[model samples]
Target: MIETIYFAGGCFWGVEGYFQRIPGVVKTEVGYANGETENPTYEEVCYRNTGHSEAVKVDYDEDKILLIELLNKYYQIIDPYSLNKQGNDIGTQYRTGIYTSNDTQMKIAKNFLNKKQQKTDRKIQIEVKPIKNFCRAEEYHQNYLEKNPNGYCHINLNEANQYSKSHLTPIQYEVTQNNGTELPNTGKYNDFDNPGLYVDIVSGEPLFLSTDKFQSNCGWPAFSKPVEKLNEKIDTSAGMIRTEVRSRKADSHLGHVFNDGPGGSTRYCINSAALKFIPYDQLEKEGYGKYKKILASNF
Candidate 1:
């Protein structure tokens, strides 16, 4: 199911870019929300007393992401204590807010605020109001970051990518974030041989292929190679100068690479909690059709 929410955090350019990186997020549109005037233009909202705040409407799939998780994600980038401004932008238009169209969203926003209040003594300055009025911003403001990669963004895109994958199962979290290794022969993918893709559990970044998977009796899912190089990194953090692998977008902790496999190929002994398998039949619908051919020939 698809759901919509609007977030007024600093500039819509950066806010929209941050949410769009999330896997379940379908699309984002920059706009002016909860304004006083009828369909105020960008300049009017900025210069004139239109009482409008720059915001972005996000559309996402509920099955892939939760509203509560999205709310927490929203809080990570903005300063809740700041008033009528965010980042370097100083104006009423840049004020932080959560304008919801429904009562359920209203409740979510309030609950989020209340929990945050319990943690800190400072009062949250964010506005939580029903959607009074909204107008889509100029075409130039929509998807601004995608058009200009080097554009100014208050939230770091690299860190935002990791935060985008915050909705994690407990085991997934322990294994991916804490460097806790799953016991040998206890993982789900250890002996499973099927045509599909293994993706990072946290960030959904594609990592390895079933075709390259080989049983080395290592008691873990062993792959001779990675499907793509961008999904990993080399690390030497743990005493042994081992080639540590990480998800490129999220920089998530995946398994390591070793050279003790057949054909001089490397072995990637990954933990089951660190991955989510996408079977061949569901690849295309899941936006991984480009790799369907990888499962064409039976091994």
Candidate 2:
């Protein structure tokens, strides 16, 4: 199913371009939203005090991406605490806001804002309200960055690709960065089950524990659960629908989770290329000695 949401994060060019690269985003358009007048032009919004904020209308597939995930991504691009300004653009049109279409969305947006407010002492200036009106921008404004490669974009489009390219192997990069799956039954840890902690290859954050590992014969290292809370997103790629898991810190794609497992437990079919195992004995040397006691009790 497709759902629509509006985001006003400074200039719409960078916001639209950044979301376009994300998976599950069906379409994006630049427009002026929650304005007073109908069919307001870009010039009117900037100079005529039309009360319209330059926004991006995003239509995303709910089965593939959640609204919260989009909101998280939105937070990364704009300063929620800044009022009527972002980057170098200082104007009402560049003000940040989240316009929702329904009560459910409004609730979610408010809750998200409340949680964010607790994290920082700075007062958030972002407006969270129901979308009152929207007017499509001019032809040149649509996909502006895509059309002009060197166009002025306040957002860093390559922020998602922040990982060091030289550090990861070809398969690791393909799996973690590009969301490519390793060949089944060919991973280094598929058949070799040793006592250790499986960590995200990119972030080195603890993911799955050895105690949770089980033989599922699914051509991947299967675990019943993760040691840490990993991010889960709906994945509708490859002609099949599944829940894709990623490391929370690095946001690197680890693998997919399934309901089929031993004794009614869920299975975390992870990619070995996306993980780095830290042996139990070397846990102290690796600065993960805190988990040594946990691993011992499980063994």
Q: Write down the lDDT of every candidate, Cα atoms only.
A: 0.81, 0.86
Model 1 — which ten-residue stretch has the worst lDDT?
157-166
What would the TM-score be for candidate 2 when compared with the true structure?
A: 0.57
Prediction RMSDs, each to the true structure: 6.1, 15.0
Name the regions of candidate 1 deviating beyond 4 angstroms: 2-6, 11-59, 75-77, 87-93, 97-170, 231-234, 259-261, 284-290, 293-299
Displacement of the residue 162 alpha carbon in candidate 2, Å: 5.9
Range of the 10 consecutive residues with the lowest summed lDDT in candidate 2: 158-167
lDDT of 1 by residue, 133-174 (tens): 889999999878766767998876655646633667666777
Judged by whole-model lDDT over C-alpha atoms, candidate 2 comes out at: 0.86
Residue-level lDDT of model 2, residues 47-149, one tens digit each, is 9999999999988868657899889888888999899999889999999999998999999999999999999899999999898779889999997875677
